[model samples]
Target: MDASFDALLDEAAGAPVDGWDFSWLDGRATEQRPSWGYQRLLGERLSAATAALDLQTGGGEVLAGAGPKNFPPTLAATEGWPPNAARATRLLHPLGAALVTHQQGTQLPFCDGAFDLVTSRHPIAVQWPEIARVLTPGGSYFAQHVGGRSNVELTAYFLGPFEVGDSREPEVESAQARAAGLEIVQCRNERLRLEFFDVGAVVWFLRKVVWAVPDFTVERYRERLRELHDHIAREGAFVSTTSRTLIEARKPAP
Candidate 1:
């Protein structure tokens, strides 16, 4: 209803949605970080491994940020989107990390036992059998995944009530990994706090993370967005919960 809210909506709507960077929302939104420090742990594992693969490496930002010393002798990253793949190549090539583009939710483009350390951050979908097939014996798969019902509050706000069930739950994933012949090493999950200070941040988030509200569009949710804007104007910020899961699994030695 206010000029500020309308301006934010227009600005965020026109903002580039390329790459995995969320720095644009820096001062406008906040999320509590997982205590395990995923990048730090991933760096440690990569430094100790001979070869490594990073799955769903959006723009290779996280992988590249892990530092040169943290990288293994052979490092490869896979991205599904074209824009992200190009960006990833630009960022990762200088670091000697090869970038491979493949369709998401499909089989990875790598040989069996191709990597000893496989990592991913917020992978859209985990093909357990394919992951196990590509990992070397005794190799490990480590990742921080979006846990069950992540950002559901935000989705419910726009799309109304929806069933999430146990999808992406750590326990269920651990069981599936074991079924795929990977031994679970560690499993941890937590619910983090999230806050959005403006409607622009919400628009940008929904646009980038399409899965949050599958068919989210400004035209479709304009009324809801306006209501949320009014609520945030009165409440200072819109708060929500985000769930995260960290899992480590190892393949059995031959």
Candidate 2:
């Protein structure tokens, strides 16, 4: 039998959201993967690098998934959120990677030209200058960034109509990288499908990805959640779009 709305809500709300893992939502929601196979590509790059750094490495999930055997001689990751940082430390230390607790928007705590490769998956914000500063000559930065207007439909649903911003645009990011003295080697963007099988999935998602609905709360958004629940009941699922960008930049050799 299908679970009740309240039951689903309680289950999702109580589910632990530690780390970057989304296994809890496995059967409740689905999102399409990019064609570039970021984790695989990351593993390949890590294999060739002598020293590597992963910025905003949420819970070190992706880094660890890239295979510790593929890790460079020197591997390090930075995460800002305390809970995530603690979780990442536990997961990454055993893999021989050091975890640095770092807040976003601050300067990276690494020496200049310290790493041959830098990578991230869906970093909240890219510190272009810091990235350039930390990369050795001829080093590269590879990452799959969350593009602008990502999940705008889902965000707009709870907040009402809003103006879309140009933040996270690939062209804008490429320009910023160039201004930071890195040459853009590759840039690609894709819009993918996302679906929520139930309101519980939506609740868990908003709770996990707090930025989606900055002020989300069951008491605050209960009415809207109920409306969405009905809509999904009639429509089978609540559909949305997600944007992603694959970007690669290289520092000059000279």
Clashing pairs in 1: none
Off by over 4 Å in 2: 1-3
- Best candidate according to lDDT: 2
Candidate 2: residue 129 Cα off by (Å): 0.5
Report the error of model 1 at residue 231, Å: 0.3
lDDT of 2: 0.94
- What are the per-residue Cα lDDT tens digits for candidate 1 across 13-110? 99998888999999999999999999899889999999999999998888988867788889999998999999999999999999998897778889
Across 1-254, the per-residue lDDT of candidate 2 in tens digits comes to 34587887788789888789998889889999999899999999999999999999999999999979899999999999999999999999999999998999999999999999999999988999999999999999999999989889999999989988786899999999999999999999999999999999999999988988999998899879888988999999999999999999999999
Candidate 1 residue 239 Cα shift, in angstroms, is 0.9
Clashing pairs in 2: none
